[model samples]
Structures are given as structure tokens and as C-alpha cells.
Target chain A: MNPVELKYNKEHEYAGVNGNIVTFGITNHAQESLGDVVFVELPDEGATVTAGKSYGTVESVKAVSDIMASVSGKVVEVNTQVLDAPDLLNSDPYGEGWLIKVEADDLSPLETMMSADEYEAFVATEEH
Target chain B: MIGTKRTPIYEEHQAAKAKLIDFGGWEMPVQYAGVIAEHHAVRNKAGLFDTSHMGEIDVRGKDALAFVQMLITNDASKLHDGKILYSPMCYPTGGIVDDSLVYRYDTEHFFIVVNASNADKDYAWMLEQAKNFEVTVDNVSDQYVQLALQGPLAETILQRITQVDLSKIIYYTFTHGEVDGVPCLISRTGYTGEDGFEVYCAPEFGRQLWRKILEIGASDGVQPIGLGARDTLRFEARLPLYGNELGAEITPLEAGIGFFVKLDKEDFVGKAALQLQKEQGVPRKLVGLEMVGRGIARSHYPLQKDGEEIGFVTSGSFSPTLNKNIALGLIRSDLAVQGDVLDVMIRDKAVQAKIIPSLFYKRG
Candidate 1:
């Protein structure tokens, strides 16, 4: 189960919000499916991201996948640690593995995203 | 994976919590512990694999050796009893039908192991080629289950359970042996870049043998490896996977396995075409590449040079052993040389990659 406080997107990205600053990372299901992460490419601070657009990529041993944005925002910070040792996404996906942070102009788009329960259900349907 | 074929050891894969995928029409595990962990295990310690999905065929009769010699491009005359020869069986046009391991049981009998997806096709091709000879071609895939115990510790781990003298089975050789009271053929041939052995036994004994190997190999740090690691392991060793590195449209000369082609041998199915290609120079060369840019190169990605697309990648991945991104590509032979840089079209980006020698890993 993912942290209940975060909002989820169908692409399996999780967003944790505080005020207008939101921290983003991939969900546990995403990291598990991607397997051992080999490289992570993320947007730099001050970069503008849009809802549903790919902000970065996560490469695993088997394949590479895009990490989509949950809401349009301006990047505030990036997790440089995960980029150095990308397998942190596999070991601490929800904690120190957070990929980036963005200052959202309008947080209402977060309402459309899934809660932990809804995301869990979405992952369950995908497994079958 | 609905309606896909399942091997005898399917339940064991599930029991180990492996992630299963449909590989060549068979439901097989792609990974168990994880790709990196399993990849490291195979490199540093040992790993076990359920290769029962691999297909085998039996060739028997008075003309067995001649039939095999004519069927494969390699010189099967060098094969004595208990020797294994790796060769590509090509069509008369020089295109490869399949690459197989020819196990010479004797002059009158031989066994061939081929890719799982090409099992039926390889058999039909063999049968079609058998009409001119007094030999029997039988698809024995269903009768046997093949398991690979690979790595430095493979012999050390397996020696604990078997009575056969492990040291006698040299590389590229095999012998009929007994494991845990079950009759099996132990082959020193390994696809991964390690010292290992393959065990072929009856289907009824597969589960027990698989369980027994894992149970005894636990202390030596052997784990059940899946196809994901199997691929990375073999790729690191510069071995080709059938569909990626070879196909019906690809010639053995172009696929960089031309060493297996014995041009000096007697006339065979692809002798004429391959002979001409060898003289005229192969159209393309399979070369190794190391990614210099950020993205990882994947299969079928265009290989471009000076903005003109020349060829495509046959296989590519972030190597767990080397800790770098690498790829195998078939490009115009003129451009393949050590230190040449090429562009791998990864998605919308043209990533710079350098052509390197194919040697990636070797056991010490």
C-alpha cells in the first residue's frame, strides 16, 4: 500500500503536497514493475512541467519508462541522490527516492488523481 | 499469457514468487529476486534455470552423422561420442533456419537442442531435409526437461549431489550421468559467460531435480534465475539470443557467428550461398556498442552515422555486470571497427555510442 496522503496518477507516479510545493516520485508498484533501476533522468529546478506530460525517465535493467507529471507546475527541486544511485527507487521509492518537486499554480488538478486505495485497486486490475 | 504453454517446472517458478511473462509462447519467469540480484548471483556465485522450454530433437540411423553434417554449417565430422558442436542450420539460400547445439551421442545417434520458439519449425526443417537420407528425425522436446546450473560455483554445488566425476566433463563436452538417482545427460556447454553445466533428464524428474539443486546449492549462494537475468548474463558473455541476433532473414555470415561456419567442410545446404558471401564479404557486421549519452539503446533502434540511418540494434541493455549501457547492432560492415562512434536512435534522441570489441566478460 502507498502512503495515504499522496495523490496518485494512473501512470503510477505519486505526488505529496505541502502548501503550493508538491514532491513527486514513482509509486511502489511502478518501481516493482520496473525492477532494478539503472538510471533516472529528471527535470532540473526552474523547469516548467505540464499535467500528464513526461517530466523524466526511469531506466531499469529490462526496460525504460517515463515518469509523468500529475499537475502543471514549475520545478522547485530535484532528488540528485536517486540519480547517482538509481536503485534507490527500488529500495526507498516512497522515501528518499522522491524524484522532483514543483510549485503548482493550481492544485485543483490533484483532486482528479487517485488516492492510495484507488491506486491500489487500479494496480490490482492491471495484474489480472 | 492465456493459453500459452507451461513447462514442467511452472509451479516451482510461482512458488519462488517469480515474475512470469510469455517468452516464445511459454509462460516463463522473467525474474525472481530481481534482475540485478539474479544477474550478480550468476556472475559472482551461481544460478539455476528452468530451461525445459528449450526444445530438443533426436536424429538416429545409419546416416546420422552425414545427415547432421549436411544439416549444419559447422563441421560435424569433428564430433565424436559425447562431444557438443554449436552450429547454425541454414537454408539453401544461406539464411539461417536456427542455431542449435548438436550433441553427438555416436555416429549413429545425435541430439539437437534449439530455441523454444523455433522448436516446431526446426523439426519440420529437419524432417524436410531428412527425406534424402536414411535417418529418423524425432521431436523429443516433450520427453526431456533441461536445467542449467551456471556460474563459478556450479560444479562445486552440483558435485555434492551427483556421483559423476565433474572434472572429466570438459567444455563443449557432455556425458550421460546420474543425479539424485535420476538418469541425466550432463553437458558442459553453457550459454552464460561462466563455468557451468546443463542437465537433461526425463520430465517426471524435473521438479525433483530443480528442487534438489536449489536445496543443495543454497549454502553456495545459488538462486533460481529467470529469463531476465538469463538474457543479461548471456548478453554480457556476447552470446546471441535467436530472435534478436538471428532469424530466417539473417545469414550466419552477417550475424557474426561465421566462425561456426565450416567453409572447408563438404557441401551442405547453405554451402554455395555462404561461400559466395564469404568471398564477396558479408553485407553487414554485428558489432558491440557502448552508450556514451544518457539513454539506453534497445532492440530495433536505428543506428545512424553522420545523420544517415545505416542499420539497427539487435540487442541492447544496461549491463548489470559491467555497470554500463551496451548494445549489439548489425550495421554496414565498412563502418564496424574498434573506436568508431555511431548514433543510436533512442526514442526522439540520437545518442552517441562507440563501437567496441565484442568481448564483454570472461570467467577467470
Candidate 2:
């Protein structure tokens, strides 16, 4: 089940807010679809990212997919631990597998993202 | 969607929840459990593959031996009964039509197995060449089904069911055998770099034979491997894939399979052009690369030397057994030497890589 507290993007990324900072990571459905995660390419901290823009790539043994940004801001921090161990994304996508933390320019962008119930409905239709 | 052909074992793949993909116009399984899992199972244990998609053409007539000798780049006169020879069927221009195996059933009968995608083309080419000789070329691909049982424990598991003496069958040799009452032509051959057997049976017996082998080999954890692991297994063995390494524009000499082409023979289709290429040396050669940077160097990725595009990668992946990113690229022959540093363009950035030996993995 998708976490009720987090918001989701159509590209399959989830965002959770803490003060003015928002954490970004791929949804559970996204990681499951990509298969075993072998490699991940992430942007460096302090890099400017625009909403809906591709920031990095996630590679499995079988395929590679681009990771798009959910909300626009400057990357404040990166999860080096997850970068070193990519399987963490497969095991714990929500906790330690969070990709980046961005200091949001404004809080209004989160309002445009889908709620947990809406994202679950979207995922159900996609699975069919 | 274009209609995709299904093999005899398509239902078996679907029953196992395998991820099916379109390969060479055939609806085939790319993976069942996972690519890495299946790859390791084949390397450390035994794995079974449904290779029924491979096309088999039969050449039989009084002049079969002489006719096949003239058609392929390899000498067929040296092949004895029940033996197999690997050769590239080339066009007169030295370009590879397809790389195939010539199974010498007898002096008057031969079975030629070609790639699935090149089946119709190869059959047409064979008929065109047979006009000069007195032999009949028949495309009997749908009449047979093929299965490959590979790994270290392959022989042990197969020995339990087959009546033929498995020990007597040497490498590249085959024998008529019965496995659980099903008759098949069992050949000690495989694409994976391992000790294995390739069994050829009738289409009606495919499902039973597949199930029986998996059931018997279940104790050793023999998984039903898909084409995903099949490609990786063969890639690490330095085997040249059809569309990637060998093609209409690529010759056997440039694909690093010149050893299979016998120019010393009296005459063959591509002899004149191959002889000319040998005298002048091929411009490009296949080489192995180990990624020194982060990204995986995939197929068609350009190789750069001193900021100039030198060649492109043919097959590459993160090797499951080695746990490192590696690739096989066709680069300028002079720069194909080992330890040479080159850049592989992976999208927008060039990743550093070092040239290594093409055979990335081999069993002791």
C-alpha cells in the first residue's frame, strides 16, 4: 500500500514534506516494475532541478530508466548510502532508499501532486 | 501489433510466469525468476532452455557433402558422421549471411541450423545455391524442437534418463538416444561456456521432454532459463551474436571468428574475398572492455579514442558472475590491443573503459 502521508507524481516518484524541505524517491510500484536495481546515477548536492525534468538514471540488470524530479528546487543533500548499495531501493524504497532532499522554492507545487488514494487508483488501472 | 510466432514451449514459459518479449519476431521468454538468478544457476548448477525457435534445414542427396562444402566457408569433407562443424555461411562479397552449424548425419545427409531471424533468408539462399549442385535443400524448421541443458551438472542429470552412453559422446559429437521413452538426437553441444547437451526431438514431444528434465533435475535446482541469461552466458564466452557481431556488412575476419573460416580449402563462396581481406588485414576487430566508470556500456554505444569516435559496442552488460560492467566492442584493429584506455559514450557523457580479452569467462 502507498503511504497515506506522502504525495505521488504520475512518473512514479513520491514526495514527503518536512518544513520547507521535500524528500524525493521512486515509488514502490516503480522499483518493482524495474526489477533488481544494479546501478543508480544521482545529481550532486546544490544542483538546480526543475519539476518534471529528468535528473538521473536508475539501472537494473535488464533495463535503464530516467528518474524525473517531482518538485523543483536546489538539491540540498543526497543519500550516499543508497548510492553505494542500490538494492536498498528494492528492499526499503520509502525509508533509507530516499534519493534526494530538495529545499523547495515554494510550497504550492505539492498541491498539484496526487494524494495517496488517487495514486493507488492510478496504479491499479495501470496494472490492468 | 505485428503477429509474433510462438514456439512449442510457449505455454511452458507462460505457466512459469516468465516475462515474455519479442525476439526475432518470436514471442519468447526473456526471464522467469530473474536474469541474474538464472545466469548463476546455469554457471553453478544446471539450467534448461527452449531453443525451438532456432531453424533447422535439411540437405540430403547423393551430392550433399560436395554441395555443402561449396556453400559454407568451412570444409565439410573433413566432417565424419555424427559430428558437427561450426562455420559462417557467407555471401560472395565476404559478408556473413549467417553463422550456422553443419551436422553431418552421414555422407548423403546434413542438418544445418541457422538463427531464427535469418531462417527464411537462409533457406532461400540455400535453395539458390543448390541450383548449381545436385542436392535438395529443405526447410524443415517446424518439424523439430530443440532444448539445451547446460552447466557443470548437466551430464549427471541427463545420465539418469538417457539410455545412450553419455560418457562416450565427446564434444561436438551426437548420438541417437532415448530419454524417458522419447527418442531424440542428443548432441554434446551448447552456446553457454559449459559442459552441456542439445537434444533435438519432434514437436509433439517437446512439452513432455521439457517437464521430465526439469522434474529430474529439480534436486540440483535446475531452473528454466530464458533468452535474457542465454545472451549473457554466450556473450561472456565470446560467442558472436548474429545481428550484433556478424551481419550483412560484417565479415567473419572482423568478427574475430576467422578461425572458423577455412580459406585453405580449395573453394568456398567467400573464399576469394576472405583471401583478399586476409592479405590486406581487416580494418576493425572485436575486443572486450571493462568499465572504469559508473555507467553500463550497452549495444551501439560509440567508442572514442582521443575524443574521436573509433567504433561501437556490439554486446555489453553487468556480468552476473563477475559482478562488474563489461562489453564487447568492434573497434579499429590497431587500437583493439588490451590495456588501451578508451571512452565509451553512454548517452551524453563518455565513460572510461579499458580494453581486455574478449573471453570474459571460461570454465576450468
Candidate 3:
């Protein structure tokens, strides 16, 4: 998982933007902290997602966590692989575990997102 | 770790890169490799657990048996030497003080193991109750550490490191033995609903014994389990956890542990209240819930019948062995029948669930 290319939300979500199609997923650190994901409740394609709002949820045996959006947009694609095999979030969080693709309403939020270094430092101060 | 206590195996857990969590004020490992993996290992092979945080109390005196009888809801007379009894200590109102295991070594000596979260409160309650009897209750929690190696292969794997005749030790019975030169109380008991042993030894030797058990169990797929899996395993077995299933407000009869409560016993603490509840019919009953709709039914989630609140979930999770979302709920006894559809509120939305028998999984 390359951290350099990713922009992070304080809520532990990530955005990988290529043109207007931005990919959304929980970060590797988030998945590791969550343990094995048993189920995922994701929004269908064409659903709207707002920056800093919950777009979906990821659940493990012990806990349920909201997956917040980093970029506001209408969802273009939903990763059915993770919905079918949720452990992809634990095993390959950066690649196969990507949750949704969105055509950005505005890419402005991307500039405000934390870099890998800043995100790591930010997480260090928050209590688990 | 500021004010929380640490068990002797704290270092071992750190060495394993375990994720530590504050469990009942004790800095314990919640998981090592992962919760789901460790859970599967226990169900299929064997898993060793560091349950050293459990509290131990020793009661001694000529009136120990009689005293125990008065304190617990179980029939103490049924216990003989080398036997164990699961009982709930209760308040006069029939509210649970805590659920504990009583190991009867003799008429004058008994060992009680209590939940870690309720240890201090239980000890205080015991001490207060001791004023009525000649027995002396000593909180010997600091003197020892406890470990459970559980699963289908638990017996075979444990037999390699201990000289104890594992075959002779029947369920709910205990014996003394030395494991790899360390003195221990080898009890054929476990919370995981598996055939296994609970080894209690001095705290200083806890790490050595823990490592040795894992090392010897390496080839057999034995792994170190954490609290996450332990709870799930016990829940699947319909074991009543203190705060979850049994509490100061929940009676034993309602918790579905009535089998352990000998209401016919001459007398015990809360006997009058429990007897009355039994005669009147238990108010709320614990039942199993299988999610018919999306979302897991987590603890404290409201359960409803036709939009009216019926009860709440005590414990809920995705069962590793069962491979689905399941929960143990305490609901009105009238609506607690099997196959009844109910609503479990998850995030203010009502999700459909069906009531089922409490034991979601049982060993063959």
C-alpha cells in the first residue's frame, strides 16, 4: 500500500483521484485497526456521497465502523468484491478493498485532506 | 496503561505484537494475529488464552461448605472433592452479585473463580457476607495466573506438556499436576464449550507456561486467543456473561441458567426471591436472535415488537463458527418463543430478526 499517492480523511477514509473519477476506501491502518471485516454495507452506484459524511459501513466481529467520504460526489461504481468477500478489506485494503468510485462534485476537499505523513501524525495523537 | 493493571504475560503479548485493550481495567491483549482467525483456530484446532486477570478467592474453615451453600444458588452438597459447581451469588432480591465457579477440594476448603470485571465488588460482597459465618475468605487473586487451552484438539495438544492423566479428568473435575516442572491446578473446564483445561499457576511462571503451551501446540494449529474470540465462543455456548446476561437486575431464572440454580435447596441467599420468581414465571427470558435483515444486532440495541420496545440485546456479533450475525437477547418471556419474528433497532432503523434457541453452536 503506497501512502504517498493517497489523501486521507480524519475519519480514516482515503481518496485516490484520477481526473474526475475519484476512488474511495478505508485506509490500510483503518482496516488493521478494525481486524477482519465480516460484512460491508455500501451504497449503490448513483448514490450521492458528501465529504465528511458516512457513505457506507464496515463491520468486523466485534465492531461496526462508518466509512466516511473524502470527496463529495455521486457514486459511479461500487466494489462488489468487498461486499462479497469483506476480508479483502483486511488483506488488500489499498487495492481490491476500494469501496466506491465517484465523479467529484468538487475536488476542493482533496487539497484540504491530510497527506500520509500528516495523517500518521494526526492518528498518533488520537486514542484508540 | 496509566491506571490499568497488567498481567504477568503482558510482556509476552507485547512480544507477539498484540493489540492491547483495557479489559476490566486490566491492560489485556484483545487480539494478536486477528479476531476472526484466532476464533476459527479455536473452533477447529486449539487456542491458548491468557485469562490471568480472573480473580481467585479461597474460603477455609469448618463451615466452608455451609457458608458456600448460603452464598450461592447452587446445591453445594452435590459437590464433592475434586468437583466443580457453576453458581450465581445473588442479593436477597434475587439480583445477581456475580457468576462464579466453585471448586470443592474438601468440606473445609473451596476455591472460587470470579469474573475479572466484578472481582473487587465480588470480594467486598464476600467479605461482607463472611461476617455471618466462621469461614475466612481470602482474595488470593495476586498469588496466581490462569490460562485456558480450548478446542476439539485441546486435550491432545495439552497432554504433550503435562504429566497429568488427562483421560481421568472428567468434565467439571479438577486435579493437581506439574506442567513442564511448574506446579498447577489442572481443571478440565473451559468457557469455550470445548474439551479443554484451565491451568492455574503462580504468576511468575505464567509466561513460561504460556509460551511452552503455544510452542508445543504449534504443529497442531494451536494459537493464542484474545478476549474477542473468547466472548464469541462462550456466547455461542449460551454462557451468561456477568454484565451482559446476568446482572444486578437480571435473575438467574431469566438468564436461562436455571439448571444451575437449585431452587429446591433448603436455603441460600436470594432463595426466597428466586423461588417466588420461578413460581410466578420468569419475567424476561434470554433467547437467540438470527438477523433476517441487514446489520448486526449489537449490545444494548433495542428489540421491538410492532414498533414497541420489547427488550435489548445483551451480546451480538458475526459468529465465526455459524457464519452469520447472531445475538443473545433478553426479551419478555411471552414473546420469547422460537421462530418468532422481532425487530432489532440498528441505528434507529428496525431490522427484522427471528428468535431461535439460545445455543447457536454446540459441539458434536
The order by descending TM-score is 1, 3, 2
Model 1, position B281, has a per-residue lDDT of 90
Tell me the interface RMSD of every candidate, in Å: 0.9, 1.1, 0.9
Candidate 3: give the clashing pairs: none
lDDT of 2 at A69: 80
TM-score of each: 0.97, 0.97, 0.97
Model 3 spans > 4 angstroms off: A117-128
lDDT of 1 by residue, B201-259 (tens): 99999999999999999988999999999999999888988888898878998998999
Please give, as one word, the docking class of candidate 3.
Answer: medium
Off by over 4 Å in 1: none
DockQ of each: 0.80, 0.62, 0.77
> Cα miss at A40, model 1 (Å)?
1.7
Angstrom error at residue B88, model 1? 0.6
- N/CA/C clash count, model 1: 0
Per-model clash counts, in order, read: 0, 0, 0
What are the chain A TM-scores of the candidates, in order?
A: 0.97, 0.96, 0.93
Clashing pairs for predicted structure model 1, backbone only = none
Residue range B1-364, candidate 2, lDDT tens digits = 2799998989999999998899999999999888888999999999999999999999999989988998899888898899999999999999999999899999899999999999999999999989977799999999989999999999999999987889999999888979879999899999999999999999999999999999999999998999989998999999889999999888999999998899888788888999999999999999999999988998889999999999999999889888888999999998988999999999869999999998999998
Give the worst 10-residue stretch by lDDT in candidate 1 chain B: B355-364
Docking class of 2: medium
When 1 and 2 are scored with DockQ, the better candidate is 1
